[model samples]
Target: MKTDTVKQAESAQINVITEESKQVIYKSLLSALTIIAISILVNLSIRVDYVLLGSSLGETSVTETLQLIMLAVASWSFFLLSKQKPHFAHAAILISGFFAVLMIREMDYWMDMIHHGSWVFPALAVTALACAKAYQGGKGTVNEMATILQSPYMKLLIGSVILLVVFSRLYGMGSFWQHVMNEHYVRDVKNISEEGIELLCYSLIALSAVRTHRELKR
Candidate 1:
């Protein structure tokens, strides 16, 4: 009778733990949605879509700068997540490194470095090292990482990010619309769409890292 009671107690504890995990995940997902929404709203307001607001979309402007900032945030968040959660360390490293590269590229340093003829081997070497590190630790595989990150909220976030890449600000370009719609004149709303989408995407990445970190703390 004592043995049966102990087993029942253990099973109940396991269930409680599982439910708590689920709640954490759900909260993280809500955070993701909030981040995306807030980013979009802020970007839209600043760009003023189609209205002349003297945005940086005219040159290699505010959009790139914003992207760089968000990438930095994402990278930092991933680094924190990696330290806090060993099981996700590999994925965190991979993502953090990628965002770092993206942030650098967005700043146009790659072009200047190449122009000076000094950007060849180092970039490739760094990339290779990062890839090796990501695949090194046996705590988790890429597939397992994907599985852990494949909740509905994450799926929505991923879908939006993919759309931002595939469709891009190209959809908002006047020439693109003119070419497709057979119109003579169309107005491109500066960099509103591009920057807005980028803000949303990077915010999602950052929020996901924050969520993981919080969950691990528990």
Candidate 2:
């Protein structure tokens, strides 16, 4: 009877822990979703303004939206990492979050280039990194190789190196690069491409959210 009682207590404790974890995860998920929604709305507003006014009324909207998105992704990623057992989904969220943060930080620089009509190369480079990271994370390649290659750390290093090279090349372009970098890159990219990139980023966030929701349900 005592043994049975002890087992029941242990089970109860585990249940409590499980419930606590679920609450934390759910809160994080909620936070991310809310932030992402706000960002999307902000971007949409900016695009509309650009189309109608032919002026950058909400020029800073994109930067603000990106910042919110980065925070949202980071919260979700941390929540995933705190799960019972870390999974590929967690890694995906983490990578996406980190990349988002980097992009957000460099938004000012990109905008400067856009204003000066020289933001193409850096913008393309950012797009490339986002696509590559999302693909790798979604496919589980990063998770699988993490054990052998030390995974996330290695991947981060590689990404940083790639960005360095790309940026260096852009800088080496001399006067043109200087002109582009000094101008606001955000205002320079065609409205269509700006909208497209925003959409793509949102899609990636949604994908991550879906995966996390599915995992939690299971």
* Candidate number of the best lDDT: 1
Q: Mark the 10 consecutive residues where model 2 has the least summed lDDT.
A: 148-157
Tens digit per residue, CA lDDT, model 2, 1-218: 57988999988887675767989999789868865875676567566656765545443545445445644654454345435335544354454455455454445555565575345455456557645654655656465336323532344334433544464344344455447656544443444344434434443444444444354435
By how many angstroms RMSD does model 2 differ from the true structure? Answer: 14.1
CA error at residue 75 for candidate 1, angstroms: 1.6
Tell me the tens digit of each residue's lDDT in model 1 across 1-218.
Answer: 46988999988887675867989999779866786686665566456533555654542455555556666876787677677767777876776776676565565554564575344345556567667878796556585468547544456546655765666655656666667657544344324555666666666655555555455445
- lDDT of model 2 at residue 157? 37
CA shift of 78, model 2, Å? 5.6
Clash totals for all candidate models? 0, 15
Per-candidate TM equals: 0.62, 0.34
Instruction: State how far residue 76 of model 2 sits from its true place (Å).
Output: 2.2
Q: Which stretches of candidate 1 lie above 4 Å from their native place? A: 1-41, 48-53, 58-62, 109-126, 143-147, 150-153, 169-175, 178-190
